[model samples]
Each structure stands twice: as C-alpha cells, then as structure tokens.
Target: MISWIYLGIAVLFEITVAFSAGNAQGFTRLWWTIATLVSGAIATFFLSLALLDFDVGVGYAIWTSVAGVGIVVLGAVFFQERLNLRKLSGIALVIGGVIGLRLSGAA
Candidate 1:
C-alpha cells in the first residue's frame, strides 16, 4: 500500500535522524544538528501520512522498532559499534514482535 511506502520512507529518515543526532554532539555541531532536525521533520511528515491509513499505535510501534533496528545495524557497520549476541537477540525479539503485530492485522 502507499501508506506502507510512506512508513518505509519515514523509517529511513528516522534512521538518518538517529545518526545525525549522534554526530551533532550535544547540538554543538551546526550541520549535524540541522540535519537531525530536518530529518526528524521529514520523518514525522511521512509518518503522519501513513497514520492516516493505519492505527496510530500500530504505526508508531512499527516505526520505532524498524528505525531502532536500522540504527543498530548501521551503527555497527559505520560507527564501529558493537553487535554482540545480546543485542542480536534483542533485535530478533523486536522483529518477532513486529511480525506478530503485522499478522494480527493491526497495521
């Protein structure tokens, strides 16, 4: 559905927000801070579009879960962050929860 596409785009932008915020270093860095704010706005815009067709609770859970997973993976690959077994297990649990939510037709 078009709403799902919007949600996906929102997730990507949310991921960008996480990384940009990290690089912002307490908002001391101008460009990264600006990037964080801009990405957050874009992400919220698409999320709003998606929520027009989705249950708000479902849409929000999916958005945060997917973006959190994306941020973790990207952090490992790009920022030399740890990808330990416990974190992987947590990721799996989050994924399972998302799948369950989808199967329940809640999103």
Candidate 2:
C-alpha cells in the first residue's frame, strides 16, 4: 500500500518531467517548468517516504515501472497521441518485466 503511494509519486514526477520538456524554452513557459520541477521534487519526496516500509530495490523498481506505464497512458489519453501496436507491445514488455520482477521476489 505504501509502495503504491510511492508509485503514484513516481508517476507524478514523470508527468512533471514531461511538462518541463514540453516547455523548456519560452520565458512564459519558465513558470510552468519551475512549477513542474518543484512539484516533481515534492512528489519524489513522498515517494521516498514509502521506502520506510519497503526495500530500496523494490521501491525503485516499482516506482520506475509504474511511472513508465503511467506516462504512456497519459500521453495517449491526454495529448491526442498515437500509439500503434509496436508501442503498445513495448508497454506490454514493461508490464511483463515488472511482473517478472515481482514474481522473482523483487517486489
């Protein structure tokens, strides 16, 4: 449960990363980028809190995989993005890898 919260934070961190990437140049965009970076750091702190209960490796792997999945989903749903079978299949690989890690006692 706590690990899941960290996973959420990791996803938010990734979302902020995307936000920053989308607006790295313009002075007007600087506000958004700063907000994104600050929020990301805050989100990552919450993520670190979950490490209190879980092993560091498990926390890292779970957070990383969850963030990866979340970004792809967000991209498709929120950004009018296109994800063909190849991309979807790649995401599936991520899922498989996460599951494999869990099954192998990494989680």
Candidate 3:
C-alpha cells in the first residue's frame, strides 16, 4: 500500500511531463522525458513490492483505473482546477467507466 503511494508520486511527476511538454524545449524536453521514465520505472518497482500478495495482472488492472480516478480528484482539489459542468460530467463518466471495468472483471 505504501509503495502504491509512491506510484502515485511518480504519476504526479508524469503529469509534470505533460505540463512541461509544450513549454519545454530541446534539452529540457529530453530531461523531462528522462525524469518521467526513471520515476515510472521506480514506481513500477515499488508497485510490484506492494503487490506481492496480489496477482500481477489484476494488481496492474486495479492500479490503472484507481490511480486515474485519484489523479482527476487530485487535479480538481489540490491543483485548484475548475470543475466546469462539462468537466464534471466527464469525470462522472470516468468514475462510471472505472467502476464498470473493475466490477465486470475487465480491469
């Protein structure tokens, strides 16, 4: 569970890559890419540790959807992102889709 939290940290840095992509140039782009890749690798390692009790396939499946939902919530609350009607509706859909995927054993 703690290592899963570290994965979330890496996801936040990955989001930083997204934010930097448009504005960062040449070497900066390369650096951000490196940062994203390294963090992602470390995150995966930790996630594996956290999932020792879980099946690899299912653990990854659940991680993807649940972390996705966590990201949106974090963006809205911590990032002070505006939750417009359309955005809120989209978030609703994401939540619904995640729920469907998890419960249907598709995740």
Candidate 4:
C-alpha cells in the first residue's frame, strides 16, 4: 500500500521533470534545467523505494504509463498542444492498459 504511494509520487515527479524539460529550452534555461534535473533525481529515488517490494516490470510499466498520460494532458492544457480524436483514443488505450495491468495484479 505504502509502496504504491511511493510509486505514485515517483510518477508525479517524473511528469514534472518531463514537463520542465520542454521549458528548459535544451537546458539553456537555468531554472527550468535545474528543476528538471532535481525532479528527475527525486523521481528516481522514489521509484527505487517502490522497487523494493514491487516487481520491476510491473512498477516500471505503471510508472511510465501514468507519467505518459499526465504529460500528454499537461501538454494539451498548458502548451496549447492539439488533442485530436486519434490522440485521445490512444490515451484511452493506454489508460485501459493501465487498468488491465492493475487488475491483473501485475503490480
């Protein structure tokens, strides 16, 4: 239970790092670049904690899926990125897969 919490936090931080990376402008922006690096390290640390109990494959899949979905939504909202039907359908598939993975007791 607690491990899942850690995993969730890890996913959030990973998304933060990824979001900031875009604004980092190829690491030219000092603040955003530093934010990216710091958040990435924090995310990795939390993931390590999660891996202590969870299966690596399962944990990693959940982490990436959650972060990927979050980043996509954030991109659409914050960056004014387009969200066409195909992209939305893809997100739905990823969400479905995540739910399936969870229900299968893969994590």
Candidate 5:
C-alpha cells in the first residue's frame, strides 16, 4: 500500500520533470532546468524505494505508463499541444494496459 503511494508520487515527479524539461529550452533556461533535474532526482529516489517491494517489470511499466499519460494530458492542456483522435486512442490503449497489469496481481 505504501509502496503504491510512493510509486504515485514518483509518477507525479516524473511528469513534472518531463514538463519542466520541455520548458527548459534544451536546458538553456536556468529555473526550468533546475526544476527538471530536481524533480527527476526525486522521482528516481521514490522509484527506487518502490522497487524494494515491486517487480521491476511491473513497477516500471506502471510508472512509465502513468507518467506518459500525465505528460501527454499536461502538454495538451498547458502547452496547447494538439490532441487528435489517434493520440486519444493511443492513450486509451496505454491506460487499458495499465489496468490490465494492475488486475494481473503484478504488485
């Protein structure tokens, strides 16, 4: 239970780092670059903690899936990126896979 919470936090940090990286302008911006680095470090630390209890495959799949979905939605909302039908379908598939994994007792 606690490990899942850590994983969720890790995913949030991962999304934050990814979004900050996009705004960092190839790391040319100071504040955004720092945010990306700090958030990435925090995400990694929590992911490591989660790995203590979870299988690597399951943990990594869930982490990346959740973060990927979050980043995409944030990009669409905050960055004004396009979200076409194809992209929406892809997101649905990824979400479905995440649900499948969770239901498989992959913890």
Candidate 6:
C-alpha cells in the first residue's frame, strides 16, 4: 500500500516533469528548466522507493504507462493539445495493458 502511494507520487512528479520540460523551451527558460530537472529527480527517487517493494519491471511499466496517460489527458485539458479519437483509443489500450499487468500477479 505504501509502495503504491510512492508510485503514485512518482507518477505525478513524472507528469510535472513532462509539462515542465515542454515549458522549458529547450531548457532556455530558467525556472521551467529547473522545474523539469527537479521534478524528474523527485520522480526517480520515489520510483526507486517503490521498486524496493515492487518488481522492477512491473514498477517501471506501471510508472511509465500511468504517467503517459496522465500527461496526455493533462495536455488536452491544460495545454490545449488535441484529444482526438486515435489518441483516445491509444489511451484505452495502454490502460488495458496496465490492468493486465496488475492482474498477472507479478507486481
């Protein structure tokens, strides 16, 4: 349970990293660049903590999948990015994959 919490935190930070990196404009923006780096470090740290209780492969897969989905949705909602049917389908597939991984009893 605690590990899942850590994983969730890591996912949020990873999402922050994505947005920050974009806002950094190739690292030319000082605050956004710093935010990108800091969020990435925090995300990795929490991911490592989660990995202490989870299988590495499973943990990493879940982390990336969830964070990817999160970024897509957030991009649409906050960044005015496109959210068309194709992307929606991909999101569904990724979600299904995550569920499959969780059910495999390997995490």
Clash totals for all candidate models: 0, 0, 0, 0, 0, 0
TM-score of each model, paired residue for residue: 0.93, 0.75, 0.51, 0.88, 0.89, 0.91
Q: Please, what are the lDDT tens digits per residue for candidate 5 over residues 1-48?
A: 999999999999999998899899999999999999999999999999
Candidate 2 local lDDT, residue 34: 87
Cα lDDT, model 3, residue 104: 83
The 10-residue segment with the lowest total lDDT in model 4: 98-107
Model 4 misplacement above 4 A: none
lDDT (tens digit, per residue) of candidate 2 on 14-106: 667766756766536777778777867876787778777668877777676667777778889988889889879978988888788768876
Question: What TM-score quantifies how close candidate 2 is to the native fold?
Answer: 0.75
Using TM-score as the yardstick, the better of models 2 and 5 is 5
Where model 1 places Cα greater than 4 Å from the true spot, the runs are none
lDDT of 6 by residue, 1-107 (tens): 89999999999999999889989999999999999999999999999999999999889988998899999999899879999999899899988887786788766
lDDT of 4 at 50: 96
All predictions: root-mean-square deviation over Cα? 1.1, 2.5, 4.6, 1.4, 1.4, 1.2
Candidate 4 global TM-score: 0.88
Please name the candidate that would achieve the greatest TM-score relative to the true structure: 1
> Could you tell me which residue pairs clash in candidate 3?
none
Candidate 2: the clashing residue pairs are none
Q: Estimate the lDDT of model 3.
A: 0.60
The lDDT values for all models are: 0.94, 0.74, 0.60, 0.90, 0.91, 0.92
Order of quality (TM-score): 1, 6, 5, 4, 2, 3
For residues 1-107, what per-residue lDDT tens digits would candidate 3 score against the true structure?
A: 46556545545544554444434555366766576566556656656664765467655655665555565677788889776887667667766875685578654
Which pairs of residues collide in candidate 6? none
What stretches of model 2 exceed 4 Å from their correct place? Answer: 26-28, 53-58
